[model samples]
Target: MRSGQTGDEAAVDVSGGSRRGREMPLEVQHIRDALRREFTSRISMADYEGRAGTDFDNAFLSRALAARAARILTDCSSDEAAAGVIDGRDDFGIDAVAFSASGSELWLIQAKWSDRGQAGFNTAAAHKLIHGLKKLDNRDFDQFNVRLQSLADRVRGVLGLPTCKVFLIVAVVGEGRLSEETEAILKEAAIDFGGWGRTVEHRVLNQAAFHRAVREDLAPEPITIVATMSEGWHSRETPYQAFDGLVCVEELANWYADHGERLYDRNVRRSLGLTGVNQTLVESLTDDPQGFWYRHNGITVQCNTIEQEFFAQRGPSKPVRLTLHNASVVNGAQTVTSAYRAYERTPDALGEAFVTVRIISVNGTPEGFAKEITKATNTQNHMERRDFIAIDETQSLIREDFRLTLDKEYVFKRGEIDPAPASGCSVREAATALACAYPDPILAVRVNGSTEALWEEGPGGAYTRLFGKQPNACQIWRTVLLMRAVRDALHDVRSTLSGRSASIAESGALLIAHIVFQLVGTDGIEEIDSEWESGLNEVPALVEGVLAQLIPLMDHFFGEGSYVTSTFANEQRCQQLVTGVLQALAEGTNVRDLTTFQSDIPKPRRRPSTVSLIIDHNLIPAGTRLEYQPSPTEEQAIGIWLRNGQGRSFATWVDDRRRPLLWEADGQRYSPSGLVTQIWRKADWREAWSAVQGPKQWYVPGEGSLVEIAERLWQRIITEEWSRERETTKDADS
Candidate 1:
């Protein structure tokens, strides 16, 4: 209805006839009814305006409408009053304010009733309400007592505190009119504004822009309104023609939280996936009757496809649009009524409406149970049926052997399946009987087939007689063949993994094979181990042989003979292998414990003495002299000479260029407590053999005297020859 038009201008006669001389009054009443109806229908939300008016008139008109809405709300005389106000200095834009009867409770609302307005209005309103509510919460944020009169001031404030209850409400009166979509929003707001174990009374007034007409009205009652001059939304379920107001933040938060489930249900119903809770009637019909039904967020008006489509095309003509389709049985009765106006009472109050449906029970044997049910009404009755009726009171009662079904003239919806025939036997029982008699013949496979004739005839003759009712032989055979192949393949994989041929040597392949075996072992397996090996003794044997070869090879090159040969050779080696094998183990265990090696050395009574030695000698007495000193810095020059001289100190040599005494010296020395082994010094060399050879070998050679060894040694002879040339030049010069 226009802002200037009276309620009479807004309605049209829904009833076909017009009363004599009552046209004007009727139109006025209809307009009033229409205005109320339209206002109520859209009370849940605000309408969408894609663009804002850029001109001053548009802006002025907007403000005017908002002011008018505020006036209407304030005039409502509800427990609360609401209005919209725009603060020029604020960036938050328009807000709505609601005041309770005593002006103690304040509800602040921020509205974005257009696409370009904002999605954060609800969030912003919630924040404001949360802040305001917290103020009323009597909490002290400054617990540190930083202020001079902190404790004292608080004590005084508490003592002087007045008895007052103020709740902050925030809500988003969404664009696009009040609708079921706002159901979730309302629930969320209720929870939030309801405050600290208490409930907040709230309502959302979703209205259209000034130029737009009220969409529709469907609320059960008029909502309490609070008017205030703040830029925000309104809370009245009734639409105030000029009001574009705000809702409380507490309202927004509560509505969001509570209605999330319903929104989720709606989205699930909108999709066609086989999964999800079957909450929607549409989904339930299309899905297998025995299959699970998915649930939707909310119960949409229980409707069939045709009625829903019709409403979609015509727009909402009533608060609820429900079409009662004839009669159907639920439990065991035929008391379903054809009266379709029952839903006019309320959306959530359908349970109170009386509905009659026929209920039928088909328990095997000839006799069955039939019932006429009239629930939500005075009369209800049931009785046994001696004979089944083809048409039972404009409804059909079809008794299939073991089951009974009741349905009025079948109305085929988009995804409805064909119903089972009205056979004398139940579908399952009939199928089972046919399968038994028609073991080979196709004609005998049908429900009403002749078993005797099929036995006399062949597959071709039986199939010819059966025609459309006969089972397709090709399809059956193919299905059976495929199943057998899959089963066999699964078994083969199982056999492979359990086979003795499963070797860890091919670790990657073996691991994959083992995984395959597990996947196919649904029925479980027997004789888990392969016949190839009863025990894993060979594995250890092979590992030992390989380790034996590697140990000696490593020892020879590194000059450490007992690296690791026998499995029990050393605890260190065993530990190394164990650590390698179980490296993936968590860091908590001690790695050294896995070793087999045990130390043979006794605990020290006293630390052993370690000694260093030097040997000084001359190869050619008085002509060319060779000397060895343990001058680590100078030892490189005389290392070989010291060793060959049978010099005991030379044993310390490791290499001629590095440490040459390791090959030659040996001795014993007495410390304060005991005798300790040491290398011989330069003083211990035997000078008697000085003239016997050119130079002594650093290492002990398998030979007797000096010259005897020189003839067998090429390196010694080369050294002697070089020394002679140098001496001749020195003597000639002298």
Candidate 2:
């Protein structure tokens, strides 16, 4: 074998010349230079420092290649990439491992670096990787080096999740076809682990891909779009050029496939990712393609230059071809992504769909014109399903009734600030509260799944059932208060719980609230100063009592190992759980101890620092975006501040626990609580509370809050400990 070359690396020669005689490709050289510059200090020196000259360089390059793969594929920062590297003597053919921020995928990277850009992934390498995968499957972390062992807990945790996929990334510095034997090895491994779901997959990152990633890292290439728009019209103004037309859904999907999120770099935000609004966009494209253009607000593109290649006569049927240079979608990013997803699902269905397009070229305009256009387009308040409810006559009547009868504000407008806790409630709160209070528990389930269902107007919809009859102001207010009380009580109860129970507390709050409402009885709820006030007062104690019975009942009906989120979201399961709990309550049956549901010993009176716990356990992957959900009081005070284009409601989570949240608004890092306090101060809200539990206020969108994530991790640790203890006991018995 050549010096510094492994057996597998020596076997394949994609390039013609010998390793020492061949000259390095300029792209490969560039990649090498960039990697050394970025990762020399970042990669652990202890791993490769023992070697000299070519050997040292080659080993370091191999580790650097793995880090690069992590950064490029996982979209993680350099720090995370370096931390992910586990390349060493006992690496088990895996150089690095990284998790997607969403926790949906775990990437296992194997890298090969060659000076002449002739790195190869041969049958030997494939077999080694497959053998490593089998060891991982058997939970044999001890076989790997200390670096891999350090991540064993996190790896086990991720692998245990049914939803998380394992991706084997084969990264080589050369471009060549994998041998049939090598391909077979990977395919057989994937099949062995795949079972019912595609649990394992592989991707090859060749030299060309590496080059693209390197170039993108240095400076992103500007996105250029070639669009053929029908019914196109141009603005006659001099300072800037603008075009208005209709673009086919197919074209938008193609752009998304090619450019992805690069198309939204200049936008205020990236695609919101399957939000309720975006889901509706997807539904429209798939279900009613022809009507999508009429129902949807079209996309706006900002470009450096626009050239009309072909223009037909001034008829609606004629198509005009335009080439847009350095283009970015400033608005309707959600629409574009949604279209892409919808197209992916049902490509044939979207042929009839078209979206209106507005393209603007600020090439000759003022310095800030492009920015101004981006700002203006995004600043305008867009309509949601709830916004349409604000226009309803019944909602107006409720607003008037609150003013005339209760002397309180009942804000129904989408952008309007929610009233203070003591004063009144918004339509959203009222809807959710009323949903829980409704006779059928499925409405509450729908609300828990997505609040959008509350505005869905139809015979069977929650909106019609709750608001179709124009519920009285007193009923709305009382139920809203009751729901608030249930939530507050549940939040306290949730803090004491861990594992699936904690998840149940978070996801099944509405269900629990609905159950509490049922037990309290809904008679005289509409009457002022009625017995319902006493029931509302009993809520805190009632919530605890109900949950004590309800949680145990859920485990009995649904298996103890069942996913709490899916259980609560499923209408049938929730209905069954509610029935079982209510029946037990009515019969005065003895309930299981709440301790049976507890996954860990009681937490200390002084809560551990969230940042420390998160970093210690590696519960959240780096570069995850956490969303800010203001406390009820803070929401009332800073609604305008949050909405004022300040980017106040989002923060990127870094690995640093002391200052985990990198605030997007000011480009500064702060502790979760510290950031909340800062926002309060910046908003000039004098009434801000002295104490803030920041983890409770920030969430990872689809995932739970920081507190919840930490609790789950703790629960997993305790469960694993118990399982080990049980195994030991079984062995002793044997």
Candidate 3:
């Protein structure tokens, strides 16, 4: 190993001046030169990529490796290929996270790229990479990726999963090799994956290993099928040998589990769900395990080349065994799926069963013919359209602009970065932000999480619809910035509210922020990002002040939300709020000062959603008790204890008369039994809430219940009646 390992602390000067004074590796130096070439000219990522394969630096190779990782893990298609490189200063020791496709594998990468000899994978770099992963899950860093929050979320998602796997991968180019000390660190660190139920693996690839793996689509190995299938087995010759036989179920299961979707690389669809035909194949295996081959169609696996071996046990009772090499399943995917499932569901039964297998070589077949073979095998299965973002050039261009101009990364594509950021705007983020900023809140309200509508080539596709025509690079960048700023501000504000109020605020956070932005009207996009040439916007104060103005109103209209289908999360409800705010603003009403909350509002019932779902009321309920309680001197606090399980749902409200309504937003209003129902039915005299057998309890901020308040009212009414009677008696005596 030619790695430049150091025993003593490698001196990293405060000024980036190396005390060892060693000449830079030619790889790093060449990379620096390539970067310098860019500094002399304004280049987009597209232009850079167009030239990178030829004249670019070793950093380009690092980027390519990252992209390859994305493609492999995310199963990303070629046209919309994406990856991000944190290669500059303050990278905190990670070249990139080899993004995971799902909530399973996480590959953390430490890359060393050079043009000539090895770039050293020494102890210091190893320590940095290890330290980075340890803290990255918690996101305790200053110079982190712009998509840090979303990435943190992605990591948390995987960590929370039942069984997560983490891999520490080192990709080296040029002279550097993994030194013993560095490898030891990786080996030990690979045991831990930040939480319970995770398995970790570590790998270090030298220069030759990295290039070879890339060239051969991951270190080509001999994939030979060895089996004993003598029942009606034969071979014939087409352009390629067509071998038909009965293969075992256990073998297919093992193959599927080990290779996953990779085994069907050329197939149109891999492992389609339990379709009718697929179920039929599985049913046949379960019902008639003895004659399964005669009943079901066999699988078709194609390969570039195949070499077969045959052997016998050299006994009178023994049968011959055959095996084929270098194979990939391309057709009859559904049939393969059935075989794999049968093995998983009932291996005992499947072992007695046999499935037909057709192995064919496609070495001289045209690419079109191969695809046709794959498509023809599954004409009944409907194919879902791939997301248009895969073909979207605008997203790529915006990502390029963000990289070239913002000096921060924007992951337009999935798996572009490991642990997708919980915050940075994807095309969805961009669309929602643009729509929210579009002087119209309808689109934002309607298409928030609808990936198909939001990213496709229609009304919701703000990227294709608005880009180049209305939005420029500066606007797109600023929209992302402001949206993130608003989210951060909301997170800070969440600290102020009760755990319940905070939850409601969060559900409605996006809409509320859009409202605030609308309130703080922009003159133009230029005004929003005028300082794009310099630093960040003064977002904390701007966004927080707007949130402060909005939360109080939300508190009032939002009620014991525990049961309410989130108005904040619901589109119609969001539209309702948006319209209400717009109407209030139009009416010259001060939305921030709209509601006045008073304590001692009496025992309150849950507020029903009458009309206004955007008021700013307090969450105080009224106290229960009548005879013992003294005459009400002042408004105390509503103390109805909300018993709903969902922590987020609840709010305060008032009727048109300006009296504080005790109920959560329409809480208990919809039950078939209520005072209104009794009144409508003209039922017999009973307690005011005798009909409500199981009403959810709510919390009174300062103390109480609607029953107590009603008691107080009844007492007042009785006392007034007696006083009138006494006055009449006195008048009669006179």
Give me the runs in candidate 2 sitting further than 4 Å from their true place.
1-36, 39-210, 232-240, 307-317, 363-366, 403-407, 537-542, 549-561, 587-590, 599-734
Report the Cα lDDT for residue 21, model 1: 28
Provide the TM-score for each candidate, comma-separated: 0.17, 0.63, 0.36
Best by lDDT: 2
Q: What is the lDDT of residue 721 in candidate 3?
A: 53
Q: CA shift at 24, candidate 1, in angstroms?
A: 33
Candidates 2 and 3 compared by TM-score, better number? 2
Worst 10 residues of 3 by lDDT: 626-635
Best by TM-score: 2
Better candidate number, 1 or 2, judged by TM-score: 2
lDDT by residue for model 1 over 136-162, one digit each (tens)? 221221211111112223322221111
| Residues 1-734, model 3: lDDT tens digits | 11132323221111223521254554344444533442222111321333433234434555444444444444554322233344333446665554444444566666655444345567777788776665553233322433233254564444333234566666555544567888888777654332222345666655554444344453556565555655467766676666677777667776776555567767776554344345456656776778876765567777666555445444322344555556678776666666776676587887777677777767777667767776776565432222436566766777777666655556655545532453335655676677666666555544432323344345554455656363555677576667777788768765454323343445455666677567555546455446542333555555544444444544455433221112443455556567666666567466453122211222212233322221223222232211111112211211111122221124343343243332343433222123233222332223333334212122233233333223233334434554686799899999
Candidate 1 similarity to native, TM-score: 0.17
Q: How does candidate 2 fare on TM-score?
A: 0.63
Give residue 216's error in model 2 in angstroms: 2.8
lDDT by candidate, in order shown: 0.25, 0.77, 0.49
* RMSD in Å for model 1: 43.0
Model 1: residues >4 Å from true position, as ranges?
1-94, 100-106, 113-125, 132-198, 201-204, 207-734
